[model samples]
Target: MGERMFPLERQKKILELLMIKKVLKLTELTEELNISIDTLRRDLNHLTKQGKIEKIYGGVKLVESKFGESTIADRLISHIEEKERIAKKCSEYIHDGDCIYLDSGSTTFQIAKYIKNKKNLTVITNSVPIVNELMNDDVELIIIGGKVRQNEQSVVAYEYLFNFNELNILKAFIGASGITIEKGISDYNLEEAITRKNMIELSKEVYVAADSTKFDKDVTIGIAPLDKIDYIITDGNIKKDFINKFKKITTSLIISE
Candidate 1:
């Protein structure tokens, strides 16, 4: 037999514990909440069903819904203002006739918006939308050929890497799932990670464009090591301690207001 849902106070307390400790095992939650193990399980099950948390083996963890999926539509809404701020900052790096590589991302797409009117620069990318964004501009648009990954709205395949190897990209603007002292940079998708990694290697300057929410959260796929990143452009809400920690790894950290 199953169990009934706990009172709202119990649910609030569960969320509190998750925020404080980051993760809680079934037994741990039950003991801390002074509830039966079965009741705790039911609460966890309910929370998971609501998308408030995720079940990981013997434990549960708070998973921000923004990090829940890497779809283009999901990303388009997750950090709209922060992306705009970062995109504005990226424009200062652009100059006429400068060759550039824009990594496929919702944030990078915003960068594309700001760069559309510029002339005499080469824009190379695997992003479908970016190609369309600059197609009418005088700026030369180079679309790297590969299999389309529709969810991210980008291309990535062995063939794409082969094509990427043949070109020398000048600058790269990439995205990340998380930046950490321990785990370095990572992404939610393995294919996106590979594409970002290759872009980083091919470029002279690599800028990671992420929002405040991306800080301190480690996802599964490793994109690149922290030392390899030249700039991290995120919104101002990133914790000072985390930013200070990043200072040890990166020389330039641009926290947009």
Candidate 2:
């Protein structure tokens, strides 16, 4: 058996393990760390209190972060079909010659894919993935320059706030880390949240594109209340209760087929 570690050392190991595995069962953790259940529980409780991890049924998982929950590559593959459906549904809203804002996220990257056939559309975005997707397309592309977040492959900084005022954005399709009736739409990164809020303020119509899994959840930063959104576009897998709840808050709740 390995020598027992100090509480801080054990806790640090637990967090490191969670950073790799994302989630681990209680028994698995104890066995791997060669610690008692009670000791593991104490460590978990401390981590939970510090907001580094969250306890789930029979296991613990790291708290969500921009790319900490899962890297952008992982997120791009996750719920791919659902994201495609949501993106296709969102594309129906875009018209030729329209200027739109696509926020940085997996779903918005999918939107970039679907809008390639549009004519003379101008896309304003901070997402590197979306920019790559539409780089050769016929549409006009505008990139918001800022600090690049490596894992998320997005740019965000306070310097672009004044730049948004000059453009007339007809529609803005934003992404959310979490969505609830109360908090509305929330994101994990403060810089991203600031960019989204500016886009929402300047656009004539604001649409939030998120997957069903994002519903009824709250995250670290709140972007705007639900009333600020004109439309909520999500996959058809969303619960009826969530659909009903969101419909009451936004002007329209669009469920992709």
The number of the candidate with the highest TM-score is: 2
lDDT of 1 by residue, 15-123 (tens): 6567435678888887777788877877777888888789898898886545557566456556688889988888778888778988788788778888877778888
Give the per-residue lDDT of model 2 (tens digit) for 68-174: 55766557767889989999999999999999999888888889878888888999999887887788889899988778887687888556344668889999999
Residue pairs in clash, model 1: none
Model 2 poorest 10 in a row by lDDT: 65-74
Residue pairs with colliding backbones in model 2 are: none
Clashes of each: 0, 0
The local distance difference test score of each candidate is 0.78, 0.86
Off by over 4 Å in 1: 1-68
**Candidate 1, residue 215: how far the Cα is off, in Å:** 0.6
Task: Let me know the TM-score candidate 1 reaches against the reference structure.
Answer: 0.70
